[model samples]
Target: MKLEKSIIGMVHVQALPGTPNNKHSIEEICEIAVQEAKTYEEAGLDAIMIENMHDVPYLKGAVGPEITASMAVVARAIREVVNLPLGIQILAGANKEALAVAKAANFQFIRAEGFVFGHVADEGYIDSCAGELLRYRKVIGAEDVKIFTDIKKKHSSHALTADVDIDETAKAAEFFLSDGLIVTGASTGKAVYLHELKSLKDKVQIPVLIGSGITAENLEEYWNYASGFIVGSHFKENGFWKNPISKDRLKVFMEKVKQLKK
Candidate 1:
């Protein structure tokens, strides 16, 4: 959970069973995830997070038991290989399910959605679940698994909280005891507004992480603002999320990060 200036690589696990995009077996998906994890570790990422992003047309709320089971199997397999901190995120506001997977897989954290405030996401309305999510974590004894929540999250409409600005959102999340705050652009792979990052610096005590659109070309611009960067698409082939991880691309980005750390 110590994410100061850390680079967390995303392992976008392929479509799982019962979803419309399920073409590969769980075993096939796990193999791809493990290989990507090895590449991320080899490329010197500080952490790895497995997400069921490819489970497209994502379920509106919590996914079925099959999705959870598949994720656990994939997460456990990845854990067996990589020594870096691991995490999981069940899509479309499945924070509770994510915590369960993290605890079972021995992951260090989870990227949670709708921690504070409501939003109209592509999947549907995701209600604020800070109280319920934290209670579940306590019930399951997964407090050690950090929950990094999204503020003004991508791929969603925040019309429900239009009066609530980014800084206010950050404060609310901090007040609700989010382990960290994730700031992102309007959509996936889009860069966050530099001014938004600047504005959030003095607003909250919790870690503020850049959750999208951080590339090696512009890493220096965001370097001093965020405690960590969660990267996915930029490390993939041709900078597309659906593409497989590109070792060379990841290495180049990490090399720059290493230089900055020095």
Candidate 2:
């Protein structure tokens, strides 16, 4: 599979639940999302993904209609502002909802949490959705929109399926027609294991992305092994998500990635 060398930045919109400072209205959230997308684009990142990461303690299946509709509006606004390849990810394993939003916003892809394997997560059981998700995508005529599946997902327990290794699970996703494979750390904002990244890259013919915990210091280490990265935390001021995206931090990170390319 062909892939881009540059890193893929994530704009984790401040749409989480129960935060006093969080935006209460959908209009407010979408406005912030648009600004964040433009910032990521200006930073020279290859692509941008908008996720409801702030919506912590996420629900198991489908979220409320308001959440989905709100997310669509935010995603659409971001798409309107940036020409970069846009992706949408609903919290937990809301694959169908995310796909719907992606289709509505004309997004290029989505980051699916539990696409091809069953596992126990903090919220509860996250059953594999590759079968249903692909069918839904077909029904909506969004076959061109890529499905980037996560293997050995973070912040969740895959111990129920521990008997199956990462390579086997990744192969299963590929068999199910996943457009790409994402290998993440054990939790959000954590770094991935280089060993696991190498193993997955060696096994798959499709694009493989590191989904978290990338920093300027480690970009060189993983750049050669994976096709791309999805970064968020390190780009923020003092490495905090709530802090604004730092222009200097982004400049430094991009410089490192460029040097590695040479």
Candidate 3:
């Protein structure tokens, strides 16, 4: 899907089974995810992305079959009700699993981590996955699923490639055949620097996305530079991730987005 100036609202699926924090049953989680997706569509978001963000202490690299299975179920349920272009993201560098889920759920794209360059994430060292991930995507016939990879991703230390600036990182991802690129702050819900985004816009040909800290008040600053915005925390109750999605907050934010579009 073309993501030009798009806003992809996040449907943070509730913690699923087999995680340390799994609280809700699979049925309950799917119901909540569908509701949030419906609200995003109703609020005029351009697309939706289902993520296993609530599965804290996330598994590194690959996840168990149950986690993959549960995500497929949740994503498919969300797909049935929400007509917008949908996407999926399995946490902590589970790119292959995410692609599989996306293929099965008819998702249009995926937010991939650690696609190029290694990093020390909370989960541990994440090796570059461009070669392996692309091969897997082709094998599974999921070439239609766009892979938007993160560069100098949040919540991780880029000490391994500290000498390489964001410009080079974007170029490397592009060289590795990324469909798009995602830029973010130091961590979740933090604001990304404006100058970095401006630099990337000049350096890369592929779409560049702002992946965190977007809200009604500050979106205008990044509006012209970003191809898309992947928003989550700001639309939640009290701007917290664990809380349910707040329709009132979504209405206010989308109103501002509409105004900017004009």
Per-residue CA lDDT of model 2 for 54-108, tens digit only, reads 8876889678786788788888889888998888889878989999999998998
Report residue 91 deviation for candidate 3 (angstroms).
Answer: 1.0
Off by over 4 Å in 1: none
Q: Which has the higher lDDT value, candidate number 1 or candidate number 2?
A: 1
lDDT of 3 by residue, 168-234 (tens): 9999999999999999999889989999999999898999999999988999999999999999999
Error of 3 at 164 (Å): 0.5
- Candidate 2 weakest ten by summed lDDT: 15-24
How much does each candidate deviate from the true structure in C-alpha RMSD? 0.7, 1.8, 0.7
What C-alpha lDDT does candidate 1 achieve relative to the native structure?
A: 0.93
TM-score of each: 0.99, 0.95, 0.99
